[model samples]
Target: MTPQLLIFDVNETLLDLSPMKEGITKLLGNPNAYEDWFSILIQMAMVETLTDKYSDFGEIGAAALTMTSQKHSKSISEEDLKLTLHLIKELKPHPEVKEALEKLKSKGFRLVALTNGGRETLEQQMNYSGLESLFDGFYSVESVRKFKPHPDAYHHVLKKEKTSPEESMLVAAHAWDIAGAQQLGMQTAFIKRPGKFPYPKGKKPPLICKDFTELYMKLTVDA
Candidate 1:
């Protein structure tokens, strides 16, 4: 099938969150706390998705941070929490992101975003990257108040594009996002950026790439 829609996942996938990770680690009084905190944050997001609850990503993030600090017996003030949240709002996109996005757009695929980020947060990220207009439309899980792997986030993008799952390709660096989209029968483009790996236990993606440029080259044929 030739996919007409291309959906992307923000954060670690497209938008680099390393700066936020560094800041968080420093705030937590441990150099690797950010890594542990991110793992816990993702786990909690899925818990919200599976158990049927609604909370913004930021709130969940704060909870995860608090848990991490507690486990490590570290103390952080409210000011530190505020600063961490602010840093998330200012993450930058990877170097190859802009050009790859442009190429995908020029190839005639309708680009869209399916983010766990709230709407305002997505706007901030896109605007900061100076590539906000590259997409045909944008969306956030804020509407459902549930994060990815729940299928709602992917379905949201499909509905907005008015394209069937088979006709839309989901591109993401995270295997969880790819797995979530694939569960809905959507074609998947796994961008194996650096240390990322395949979904632990779910329908695996159909295609894989080292970066967006690799995915872009293979996009000519679509699915």
Candidate 2:
């Protein structure tokens, strides 16, 4: 069935993260710095969720960056870390994002963004991307003090929107996010952005697209 609500994963899915990746790699003087830090950030976020604890996503990112630097035998100042990470708030949308979003909105689909980032940062990122006006709402997992892939995170959106799992679909580039929503019985779309892949062990997403334009095409037909 076609979904009534379309939930988007902001970072890396709608907005491109390559700029921030470049900044992070340059800061740490290591080509693998961004990937390493992101891996740690996700792991620590899950650690918080599993332990019934809460911490700001930005704080986790900073801590992860520090750990990555240390692992590389490099020392980074707090000032530099913050500066480099701030790049996240200035990301640009993927080339096809704006047009696709507009098309989806015109088709009367409720669009919302759900991210693990802090609320203030999520707002800044959206506004800065010039795609802010296209969404019906912007949500941060901060409200529930949990990160994505945790049922509470997804539930927060569904509860706030008053949309049922079966009536809503999650569109994201991350396999873990797709798996989480799929397990909850929500419709799922796996965005196959470059360097991202589907989870082989998870249930297959009903829609897998190379970008938002493709997603718009498939969703239009489905609707």
Candidate 3:
């Protein structure tokens, strides 16, 4: 079924995360450190939610950076941590993002962004990418004090949009995010970004496209 609303995940889905590679590699002294840092950040966010503790996504990210640095026996100064987190606000859209969004919008699909980033960070990132005007609405998990993969986060968006789970589809790069949406009864599309894959044990997403362009085609042409 064609969805009435397409809710997108902000980080790594619409925005390219390559901007963070330099800061992570410089701080951790490993070219592959970016992946490790991101994984830890998500893990900690889940930890905070599961433990019934609330922390801003940015705070969890900073703590994750510190933990990753210490795990590697590297010392990351506070300034360095701040700089690395700041890079998130400077991310650019993936090459095909603008065109794909335009096509989807022109076709009358309501577009919204749902992110784990706090409201301020989400605004900054969207403004930086110059894609803020394209969305009908933006949502942050901060209000719910939970991260993606948590049922409430997904439910909050459905409630706000007045769209039922079956009428909305979630498009995300993270396997966990897709799984969460799937469990909540929303159709899901996984953007197979570099080094990203679906969770092996979860319900499979109905659509797994290579990128935004592919996703647009799949939804418009194939669906």
Number of the top-ranking candidate, with lDDT as the measure: 2
Q: RMSD to native for every prediction? A: 1.7, 0.9, 1.1
Candidate 3 root-mean-square deviation in Å:
1.1
Give every collision pair in model 3.
none
lDDT of 1 by residue, 1-223 (tens): 7788888888887888888878887887787788788889899989988898878888888999999889778888998888886898887788888898998888788888888878888898888878798988889999877789788887877887788999998888888888888889999888887668987686767778888778888877544
TM-score to true structure, per model: 0.94, 0.98, 0.97
Order by lDDT, highest first = 2, 3, 1
lDDT tens digits, residue span 1-223, model 3: 8998999999999999887988898888988778888989999899988998889999888888888888778987889889888999999999999999999999899999999999999999999999998999999998898888899999999999999999999999999999899988999999999989999888889899999999999899944
lDDT, candidates in the order shown: 0.84, 0.93, 0.92
lDDT preference between candidates 2 and 3, better one: 2
* Worst window of 10 by summed lDDT in candidate 2: 24-33
lDDT of 2 by residue, 128-223 (tens): 999889999989999989889999899999999999999999999999899889878999999998889999988989999999999999999856
Global Cα lDDT for candidate 2: 0.93
The top-ranked prediction according to TM-score is 2
Arranged by TM-score with the best first, the candidates are 2, 3, 1
What's the true lDDT of residue 137 in model 1?
Answer: 88
In model 1, residue pairs whose N, Cα or C atoms come closer than 3 Å (at least 3 residues apart or on different chains), thus clashing, are none
| Candidate 1 colliding pairs, count | 0
